[model samples]
Target: MARRGKKAKGRPISGWVILDKPKGMGSTDCVSKLKWLYFAQKCGHAGTLDPLATGLLPIAFGDATKTVPYVMDGRKTYRFTVRWGVQTTTDDTEGEAVGTSDLRPNADEIRDLLPNYTGEIEQVPPSFSAIKIGGERAYDLARSGEAPEIESRIVTVHSLGLVEMPDADSAVFEAECGKGTYVRAIARDLGRDLGCFGHITELRRTTVGAFTEEDMVPLDELIDVADENREELDEEAIESGAKARILDFGPLDEYIIAPEAALSELYEVMLNDDQAGRVLAGNSVLLRGRDAPAFCDEAFATGHGRLIALGAIDQGSFHPKRVFGGKG
Candidate 1:
């Protein structure tokens, strides 16, 4: 007889969770904890936050993972502090100091230099980064002493300004940049230009795509609710008056943002019932309205406020690429 296939585990929960990641927790570890807490069958993060960094980390469960690329492509906002006297291997506090300087830049001097780093600029990512080289992670290569050569790439920095100079040793700055822009590289390059070798002492991501500071739910808050609800369930069971099932999610469902929220930036095409059915069946439907886009590289269709598919519009026809839970 043929061996049976392995059964899938956990609940088929699907949605987005904007985690206000605390310092000292890796992004992967945070996702793992969330998976266990929610008992979700699948979980993934939209962006990676360093162990030393903190702020908005969008966690995706189930089908929401299909939209991760869109979130990653969105603009990112960060407020980081640069320690002006040292340059570290990792470009942040976690690495050894490889260079030092006594010269510290004043506010006026830093202000004058901001324009050069803003808009489009060429940057060499920190050696200790997630960038892959030769099918191996750059950080791993750096740790193994392979000293990988990373090429400089063009990245957009929409805005960059000095927020304040906390002391002679550090300067706080805020920036809004496009994908692939590294905050560490900003500090490193700025320090080199100012003649005051620097590295990021503090880093915090304030926004990514449609997700913002206001959307974040801290890890501890979720844990607290999970524990409290479980205790209540146990007590009710002992009393033989169980009003709710232990696995019912209780108040935890409130934190799950709908998966369609991640696709807000994409062009929206409203589909009729027939269109929605066709789209859900992996078929294309003719867009009948004059308001319909002539052509679009990417667009999402929704029927009665429910996400149906993600695809492109060409010649007044909407093609379905990725179908979702919109078919009734």
Candidate 2:
């Protein structure tokens, strides 16, 4: 008999890659670079970070993409520097200066006033943003010299604190907030609140979901590592040395916490093998023998399962809300 083709090997590696995005590059550019590096079949980002900002950016590959929305819904933290006395069209250092002010509030005054912004409050997004109006991107309209009316959105600011007051005209602060919150708007509003126009001079996202700046690997460092690995293969002197050497490249699991780890904060329900199978087969579970919320009514209207994954349980049934496939 002829030899078989060695069973076609194993499946492609899949997981998340958290990049420490460099300033001046858009989020899409980061994804494109990673796709080439890994030769992945599919990839996507959980959220978009501004080109002017730098920090933790979660890029999901394979089945991990299914868990992205849960991760993106988590809270975010940022540290930004605001410069008083000038306002800008885009609200950041990159924008053209549009207005000026002479008043400058003292550090103590700003610290005391910071409390008013904490907790739940409504905020308006900057004009030059990604928000859509009448199905057109706001920034596209803005670049055409047309000012479209933007609406205010209600967002929660979990906490706000002054980090430093470098001078009478500039201050640094930290903000913890929910999704969709804009630091530029906060800076702009802070200036107006204090009787002076203001705009952000610097902004950096320190944290997104569970990932933080500490977990980030600089782009230059990554590029250097890649170059070093390539050199090592050349020295090996094998016919396919480069390809063989790169094959030893490990999975990017350092950036991905366990799938369940991402949902540890949520109420958990374990399912038996039968329940797990049913969930995987697309069926809503009644979740009997446990205190799980009544899920029968919430099951899919078509009777097909909508759960994504199932978890371990000592006893009783818990429906799967999400599923993870090794090759997803």
Q: What is the TM-score of each candidate against the true structure?
A: 0.91, 0.79
Q: Give per-residue CA lDDT, model 2, range 218-301, as digits (tens).
A: 766655555554524455566654453334334333444444434434555555666556766655455565455543322211
- Model 1 / residue 47 / CA error / Å: 1.2
Q: Across residues 230-304, which tens digit of lDDT does each residue of candidate 1 receive?
A: 644577586997654345585787899877789998999999888888888899999987788879999998885
State the number of backbone clashes in model 1: 0
lDDT to native, each model: 0.90, 0.71
In model 2, which range of ten residues has the least summed lDDT? 297-306
The C-alpha stretches of model 1 lying farther than 4 A from their native spots are 1-5, 231-246, 325-328
